[model samples]
Target: MSTRAPDRFHVSSAVVLCTPGAADRLVETLAEMPNVEVHAAEQGKIIIVIEGKSSGEMGATLAAISSLPDVMAANMVFEHAENLEEGLINGHRTDAA
Candidate 1:
């Protein structure tokens, strides 16, 4: 059986910081995530990517990350997957008149 990775673009939010250092600590806090990808690290800061299915899940994930001492701040870079989704829900026609 082959397993495919989850949608990367659908990434809800990220936990960014200098460094948590302790894998055990990070693991305990992010036990929900079966996997984690570390992008870059400097001095003691690093970027962690989180994949959440919904906004509520995303909020919880961020909260857990924030509780970590290493986390400086976590912010959602993009909202709601994409802008076009927002437009359609608001009743804006994509077909330019």
Candidate 2:
């Protein structure tokens, strides 16, 4: 039996670049995953969020989606709390008058 519990899933964000005319197909494929969610899209880019039990599982899912012929790249934009907190804290400073 495994003694370690799976890593808890939370909010994750990534930017995916799709091949020409492949956004629809890419979104469709991503939609198939149980916890994967496509939040936004533009010209040839897609913004997605995923909830998984572990980093490995999330990576596997992202890899699967990115490996699709229509996908050009799937770069993670945000995936952890520390990243967000730092950005948030920096954004709101006492100088913002």
Candidate 3:
């Protein structure tokens, strides 16, 4: 049997820094973006998760977040990608094929 590579999956965790007294506004703005989830907010910093089918999409979203008003910076803490087809053992797919 022949197998094909799986679709791309990208996940990124980032910390967005807000200007003084700007955390609330930043959180609201982030909430409006697609595939962006605000996990926590405190002391001018917001923890967020970005997910997309491709890394390029995630990067664009991150850049957009950084450009929002009162956003001081958006720094990626971690990033990961997985190919579903690669999760195989003994030439058998670990996940549903």
Candidate 4:
């Protein structure tokens, strides 16, 4: 018998462009979202990292961000997925296959 692991953990980074002087408000709003991290903000660009159980969840979050007022665009820059159970069992990363 075998037990299957849960869904892969998905991580993604995005560059969010906002209208002039909206970075501060956007950062504050993003900070309140679960599993979302604001890495930096300068000028009108905000760097954010988000984590989720699946790619669909991450994509949905990105879409929501892009639709926010003052947001000009939200583009994903990086993405990675890993099987946490496999990584933990081997004590090293065992990225999804």
TM-score of every candidate relative to the true structure: 0.48, 0.70, 0.82, 0.84
Model 2 CA deviation exceeding 4 Å by range: 1-7, 81-97
Instruction: State the C-alpha lDDT per candidate.
Output: 0.53, 0.74, 0.87, 0.89
Considering summed lDDT, which 10 consecutive residues are worst modelled in model 4? 87-96
Ten contiguous residues minimizing lDDT sum, candidate 2: 81-90
RMSD to the true structure for each prediction, in A, is 9.2, 8.8, 3.1, 4.3
Q: Give the winner by TM-score.
A: 4
In lDDT terms, which candidate is top? Answer: 4
Q: Which rank order by TM-score, best down to worst?
A: 4, 3, 2, 1
Q: Candidate 1, overall lDDT? A: 0.53
Higher-lDDT candidate of 3 and 4: 4
Q: Give one digit per residue, the lDDT tens place, for model 2 in 1-97.
A: 3344333445578899988888887788888878889998889999999776666777887888778787889887777533223323434423422
Each candidate: how many clashes? 4, 0, 0, 0
Off by over 4 Å in 1: 1-9, 13-15, 19-32, 79-97
Local distance difference test, candidate 2:
0.74
Q: lDDT tens digits, residues 38-58, model 1? A: 555455444566665556666
lDDT, residue 87, model 4 = 45
- How would you encode candidate 3's per-residue C-alpha lDDT over 1-97 as one tens digit per residue? 5465567789999999989998987788888889999999999999999999888999999999888899889998999987755776545667755
